[model samples]
Target: MTEIINFRAGRYKISFHILHILMTEKYENNATQVPSSDDTLLGVINYQKVPTPIYDLTRILEGSSAQQQMSDLIDLLHEREKDHVEWLNALQSSIETGTEFTKARDPHQCAFGKWYDSFKSENEDLKHILQKFDEPHKVIHSLADKLLKMAATEGKEQALKVLNQQRKSTLRLLLNLFSAAREAVSSSYKPVIVYTTLNGATPSLGFLVDSVDDALTIDESDIQSFVNDQAIKFAGELNLPRMISGLITKDDVNSLLIDPSLIDASLPEAYENEASLA
Candidate 1:
């Protein structure tokens, strides 16, 4: 039941074994720091003290450097922050004055304003910091990881279906890299290649040119004991939220390269049983 994931980038045929961790999570040598370039897909999560960049396999396969991608995403958010602030101000004024638009034009304004106000008040430094420093798309990327996990344990069938849907929704992101290649003197210098692999015995490899990436197999072991128990399910719920994996594709030969030893030894078994019903 090994699911063969194939992605075409120029001429190379990328493939790998998908392994399911029985108990512990492994992130490319247990790394907790975000990768500095497009060649590494895994990132460190920095919810506390230092941020941890969780690798999105699909994005890595697509040729985006984790650090640069994260920074660019933060920049995009900063660019839109002004508009968000304006919208927040208008909503606040409407709510205070009881303007007709308060309810009719932006009914959700109150709730949204409250959310923004909280962030603004607590993190007044956020705006100033954004002006000087930018981070990558870790938040959304993290959310995508969580959602994918949900699809893994709670709804494997449904999750795979959602990934199929994302192919179309994420086309714009993929096109951006191609456009960058066109504008750059050398595509290699442009951070267009995403090097990524799930490290395990029987490691799995995926390639994504832009966002043409799909939900490669998300194989999870050590779940049979918790299949029906609420507590086990709860445990799964807690663990899956932070489990992240994805793929990205690119044109450069070096971008898609991964170390053979990084893959786990038990991957062959994982690949055969990635699907729940299988």
Candidate 2:
């Protein structure tokens, strides 16, 4: 028998757990980049004797449309594990007795050879001895399974950790250093770019304009009015979740706030009373 299920998303209400799955997946820059179909998948995982989708929220947020693609990624991970074991065992024996980079076939193999040589030169005899029985394939498979479990158990916390560890401020320094490089590419180009972040996630926008202009700030009350106008139009056209209260622009970034009244909303249901920012 088919059972009906429903969920909340912002102010919009949805029947499919698809919205919940997407919510678990983090979106980049208003859903601009699609996520790579890798990691453990939902849908095929059997729990309590029933098949359940084991979704990686990050991929969903990146706009992965097919569950089968995600399943394929999981299978690929297993295959890689098998290959990793063979490579590690091969590397260990070659390194213990002294492997030669000259005999390596590919760049990756050559790099590994160089690493082993460097390790041997540093008098790391223990590492050299340990390399022979490394059983790298087994480790890779174990790590993959652990990662899948972490994604399933921790959810948003794991997502936040992934975002925080990966987003680097060094990109900002590189951008400033290479400003001249942009002009050298095209003499007629006058480009302006906006660098912003969402919860420590790096986001960028480019604007090609003639010249710089003054910046302005608007009051929160006025912004709310603007959001209401856009929300009315968005709701009509998109058929987005009824739980979506409306699109709101806060702290220079726009987020679709979920309605407090909706039962299926993914946004936090609890709130704490705070006195002031100061």
Candidate 3:
């Protein structure tokens, strides 16, 4: 088995060999400004009395130009859906009798159908939301389905509990998704900085991360090399240095294994010079 340190970057969970880890700490210092030539270089932080350049992991993995266009469009769709759902519920409540509530013409074809139909048209866009649902979306969607089922068969209070939980979950997920998407699209993206050594070198370097997670020792057999895969070859077209060497599977989830040394040569000349002098 190979020991690795797992960490979160944006929505991704990635791992690196524990041997490459120099030290982990809560980022509390502001990095000194650097020239704007390299977009990957975030800034420089003082490490062991030597200035170390901080690189943005997200920006390096996903290019700065990556469009969150799909995410924005999905948000619009969700907002419209929320409004429509609220309207439908209100309309149903206004129908004095249970029979009227049940007898009410199809909302999509009634006198106010145009209002309902508009939302229906927008629903088509949801198919484009995301081919694969992220954790947040999956949880929210699952809770919503359960909420509807419970409301129909179980007590109102019981359903309300599920609804409340969903509301909280939705809010948190929205914030996380929005922040991650924003970072992907924003011109000025600043993430949390981490300090570590390149191949256990003397001078430590700082790199940006979304957040830090637990460390784990994964089985070496679980790691699959990316050497000859067509997809990995296509990833190389992006011209990223030392991006991902292999993927580690733990608990059925795959995490990319990043080696700091892979990107050491890609650091700015000034940073390289500073490391050499140190």
Candidate 4:
């Protein structure tokens, strides 16, 4: 079993041991400015006389050059989900009328697919979930050609039944994914800064996230594995490798787990002295 503190950062659920989070509060852009090439470094904050580096979790973890306005994206997703439902309805209607079914066969051509591809490749925490839609989305789009050919031999009624079955299965899955996508973004709130001063002797560090979620305990099995290829590619591309030790998205344990003990050492030693107010 593990005790974890779950939170949202750019539409992704992330968690770490509850013991690591000493306290959390509303972020107040008060970090003392410093010169560092590292973008994740949001400057330092004086906490208990120690210079604590405040990192922008949303900026670094989301794989976006600019932090996404989660609220706006939530509305966009709602509209896209509705568009997909209508897309399916139109396909059914065309099949029933014995007319040409002309629409985007290429998944990337659809409005939703365009946005999906354009979304900066999500970080490891979200890549797996987003990729789950690829096969289903492509399959749904390809249905028109397949069903239209089948209708000539199988009869309109049978073709219509096939379309309905697809609506219940593939389309339903996409809609659920859309809902989860919406939930992921809606989970965000005004940015929060979580401060940690582990055991008094360790360096205090602060993390800026979209919002904080509840703390809970769960069995070790709740921790999920990441795709090794995706993890490696993300780390290699970002160069600012996040020490995301493990990820879990089940029950109340949605989060990317990191060991707080490694946080200070993970950065360049120059960070420790950049703005040492202690």
Compose the digit string of candidate 3's lDDT tens values, residues 1-278: 78887776645677778887776665554777665566666567767776777766656666541124334534654564454345335433432222223222333343223432343211222323222224444444344345445656785567666555655666455454444433433422224556667657554667667556767877778898756343532121223434568878888988888767765654556656544553
lDDT of 3 at 86: 52
Model 4: CA > 4 A from native: 65-188, 200-203, 224-242, 252-254
- Among the numbered candidates, top TM-score falls to 4
TM-score per candidate, chains pooled: 0.21, 0.22, 0.51, 0.53
Per lDDT, the best of the predicted structures is 4
Computed on alpha carbons, the lDDT of every model, listed in order, comes to 0.32, 0.29, 0.54, 0.72
Ranking according to lDDT, highest score first: 4, 3, 1, 2
- Expressed as tens digits, the lDDT of each residue in 189-247 for candidate 1 is 21122233343322132212222222243233311121222342111111211121222
Tell me which of candidates 1 and 2 scores higher on lDDT. Answer: 1
Candidate 4 C-alpha lDDT tens digits along 68-161: 5665677888898898788888888787887666678788998889999989633443455577889889989888888887788888888889
- Of candidates 4 and 2, the better by TM-score: 4
User: In terms of TM-score, how similar is model 3 to the real structure?
Assistant: 0.51
